[model samples]
Target: MEQTVQPCPQCGTEIRTDRRFTTWCSACDWNVDPVEPDERPGHVERMRRGIAHRYGERLLAEMTRGESPRPRRDVAGVLAYAVALCVHGVTVALFVTGALLVTLGRGGAPSVLGAFLLGLAWLFRPRFGRLPDDAPVLHRADAPRLFALIDEVAACAPTSGVHAVAVTAEANASVSTYGVRQRRLLTLGLGLWEITTPQERVALLGHELGHFAHGDTRHGVIIANALHSLNSWRYLVAPIRNPSGLEVILNAFYLLPFLAVQGVMMLLDQLTLRAAQRAEYLADATSATAASTEAAVALQDRLLVCGPAEALLLRESNARQVRGAAKRDEPGQGLWDRLAAYVESIPEGEYERRRRVGVLRGHSVDATHPPTHLRRACLLARPAEPAAVRVDAAAVAAITAELADARQVVARCVLRG
Candidate 1:
């Protein structure tokens, strides 16, 4: 077969051979859309005139050139934090004032009003909901080998340190902070680990730790808490349904403040969360640096395999359990082996088509990360040498040893469900 490369009509970047038929440009995320034709004259002009701030414009341009532009402090993030603090203050004040009235108002209308305000304030009080700290914890002492790898990664990251690690049934990994002091915790999903090669595991770890380096994960925590508080306030102040005319008037009055606060918070989320998409690119670059570019790209490719592969495993696990195979008792035995076999069986053409679809997905308001294709392009444009970190076989064995029981429990729980 003859391979041809041509410049993208839109961006003038050389389009790779594999993407020629798709007419996709990784540099600009431009693709020929059969569904939305360029014959619409006004479309190009409208896109050219799209409203964006100077910072956003510059950042996007850098991304197009496969560069990792440093993120700026978000005005919306700062304002949202201020709003959250004010809400907390107001709730506390109302609670204190209402308590005084209830204590001294001598059982009149004032006392009744005081009781109502107190209840409303209690409902609105800032709730930094508890994390699952009690979930299967792997202390550093218990898994020194895992901790060593984490420490090495942390050295390359901007975070001070990783304080705790949790293993879960999820096929994902994340870093989070918990409690008032905001101690950092790293949660590793056993399912992802079981399927990934050792180097690919490094890429996964690097990407997650990169979020901490960029402060993206911690900011998400703040945003989540702010949204939670806003929701609580909205629930407290929501208007009564099927009300009389006077009640309608009173309800509207009560609901207005909550409505305004929630609206502003939501707007701020929209403005600030676009930064998160860039953060993901930077995180991927970090992975490419810490692990080899090959490993980083391979890890992403493996992730694409996960959806179909997991479905196959799920079915097999179900069948085995139904046959009374005692899959729970057989820890080193079931789904992982079946998943490897299933993935190995996938046809090359089918895999490539699925991979193309995975990479060509367009950006949306709700998407937190750049398309995987863009990420791959960025890394290829500026390749990095793999970090000189390798886990000894003994260390790998010990880490897996520590998580053995937890993996079995998680596998059984997932299969049972």
Candidate 2:
């Protein structure tokens, strides 16, 4: 017997039912007024066609922009290290040297030193990889299943194979965009693991592929670090000048000059972030293209709702604990804040805030990612998509692509394990 599709309550037409409790009849083009419920196959088909057509234009736009270039593994590594190094290097180099610059009243050494320090702190600040380190990092040779999916995404757009694909847990994932060479790094977090089916995972990966297609996979990282750098000079300087103890007293005496410099850097930071927001939208569009609109939507839905409330809360708490542990291990700190010149020099306001946000928001320095709800809604709006049951087309292409050479290089690293 043929299955009877449910019709919309507002109009008599075939429509897929949803757990969300929202129903509409696409066949009648949605009624101007509510209708009595009825079961009709013809009505169902018509409604289905209507809804499909209604969303079809939007969905197509989202899916066609698939494929992302993989970040070069070395480049990704460099960024991760460089950002951190930039912060430390400039802080020490500038601050120690800045004293002389300040003394000489050199043509703009103070400004130059301030600018460098700002950029350094910005690049190295913590960010939300929310995905854990323990998550599986799929190498080209290892995880044929996952590699096949990536290949398909690349075919939809020009791309080098991803440097890595990881699951933060059973449920969620993130793709890396920054670095020198083309590299895409995926992190599938625990939340993603818990709520989604394997089919959904492929769909989710497709969204990351979308980022590749739109060229959003890498540009923003540089931008984000740059903005942070712009702001951090204020952070680096305020601490050097004020030493944090009594802001009120300092505010009365030196507030004008402090605010003057801070205001300029703030403007620069704002300008940089404004540009970053536009880039984020491009990445979102990429998510829509490589995967089915529905799958993309569902994958995000699964991520937001999957993890327990406690896990979310605990994550931040745990992040704090981890930072404290790291600090204790460092050679200079000596398990105490004895007011060293360097420590005192780093604007105290930015220091603790950066640490807190790392654990709290996931990104230590810049909270660039959009909120969970907005991200989920954007993905969900694309509803109805092709399944992730197949990846053969992509796999074949990957085997022959130029990236095959790159894969071999990464393969050597994986082989060591």
Candidate 3:
């Protein structure tokens, strides 16, 4: 609650700061990146990060040069699709072989073996995404206002709108296709949603829906299923821990298949890596287009603080647990309200530090996304534009009211965790 002033160590510029937050020189960006780069990533992760950095830089340059960010049908894209097709082909072959053996063997030993093969086929079958059973599902009828906002964002992205919304306790949001019909579903994480402003919420929706508009092959049923099958294969053939003599011999037999699967998986990842980065950049642009460049860039800034928000939630949950359920259910102390306050309380200097850290460490939302700094840069590279879809105070209130019940459910889930 007190302000302090001192000369910056890096530069003798007078710096005014709050005691509650980090003190850094605004003039020279002294101590802008306070955190050290994490050294925990393995060799594979390091390699992937390197690739992401390279791709992000190149794509940013291209976009700055006035090139449209369209998905390229280049050699890597073609090869990746071919590999995905081959992966699916193996699944089909297994089914066909099992069926032939069962039909021709006439209930003999061959038929029994055929049944085993069929079981294996079923085990490795392509998986269509499914809605989480535990998550709170909000249908259009249940949340018309929220769905309307989502539809507005989807229309701005020019993609198919989501069929349903699923509320979760995580600090991230994502869109995916689910079930045999490939219906679009938007997973709205209350942790992130509650902290974002109305405009930033639109930007978040825009970025996710942009994946569909941008033709991100990784999210498609074909490639997604291929990746799933490969992961399953990898899990099956993985080396065992503390193996018995007989198990050691079996592991020796499994080693070749394990190496082969890993090789294929790496190949697929390498082939699609550039395209995935491109899709993310494109999605960021869509976010800017739908919610204005300022809103989109601000959304990225908000993302930098998600770690702190989650930490606050964890700390609150632990304290509440110590106080027992009676204290947790006390009125006027809603989890969402606390989360919003904590996020709003984050200092501007802290955000700048995180932004600089992201630039230094190549920070990303995940392995699949481009570095956040680059995404922010890409949005700012273009001229700032007005939002295509704006959420006024009335609309925000309506949407918030619609999500009230879901918020309580997610709040309980977080506290229980």
Candidate 4:
């Protein structure tokens, strides 16, 4: 079968393709594939009504034959979606008006103004740019054992399978989809991978893979694109800094209308985006389902401890590397050991203190994930289970061996960043 070449959904690196179940990225090791939504009881109906409710339906009932009753409306989220739709509608209206004005004006002041408006519209048109591919994309051919681990994780997950896998430099693990097709991509940060135990790593992968269960990222991408469009429009129309008096006055005329539309869109986007916190909790449950409640909680605990510790070490390492005290080809084993030691050096009470304080002073309104404390609370409340995922020693060794080149890739990316 011929393969479709596309950017990795997670990191936006171009994928290397062949006849296989999925597209692969050697630059980041992402298994990219589009997984269809499972038949959730009334899910499609619920989503359809959610869209309908956004467009001014008050009484919730199925208009079509054999459809379920409308689900409880999410007023804020629906309103946000509506606002985004309005922005799109308004943008199209502006384009049409501008084109008509330009045609009718025929080299008059109206023509000049219309041409300028058209230029501005072009400048602010919705463009969903790809992310920088700073990680190493991988394939099953590159690491069959590691790919097997992903398969095992997928089997345990509610989702079908992982599409692509990649390795990044951050002390984090995440999953994302790219392009209009919603191809899924999984990214594992080498910093997190190097320090975590095999079981914890499985737990981490489970947490990320768990996102597919709820189909969270699918809608998230839509909301994100809406916000991106609004932001672009806002910036394009915004007045230049320190403008002359007349320029400022002229800019005010241009910006006021753009700001008015963008303001509502921004508000709605925040409301809808904030509601994604529930998805975070659900995804966390999926992780527990794949691994165990204990493993999930332990993973969270480890992240809370290691996140800050990793940052501290990262700064130190970068400084040493900059000063030429560190070697580029020096394997990551020493770096991993130093990270472990750094975490160990912290007092037990200090770890507790950090965990208790939460990761941030307070959660940002735009934060997708719930507070760390809230996540821990939920995990602690869940019923415990023995670790469901077993560590494959040979697989682990092979994965580690394969990542030797990845370490270098990550190092260069990190330093460049």
Best by TM-score: 3
- lDDT by residue for model 3 over 130-158, one digit each (tens)? 88899999889999998988888888778
Residue pairs in collision within model 3: none
lDDT of 2 by residue, 29-58 (tens): 343223332654365345433443333334
Per TM-score, what order, best first? 3, 1, 4, 2
Q: What CA RMSD would candidate 2 show?
A: 18.5
lDDT of 2 at 405: 36
What are the runs in model 4 whose C-alpha is more than 4 Å off? Answer: 1-73, 94-131, 217-219, 239-244, 325-328, 364-367, 412-417
What does candidate 1's lDDT look like per residue over 25-90, in tens digits? 656656533334335435423332232223334444586575544555767657656765665677
Better of 1 and 3 by TM-score: 3
Look at candidate 2 and tell me the lDDT of residue 4: 35
lDDT of prediction 3: 0.85
How many Å off is the CA of 411 in candidate 3?
A: 1.2
Cα lDDT of candidate 1 equals 0.66
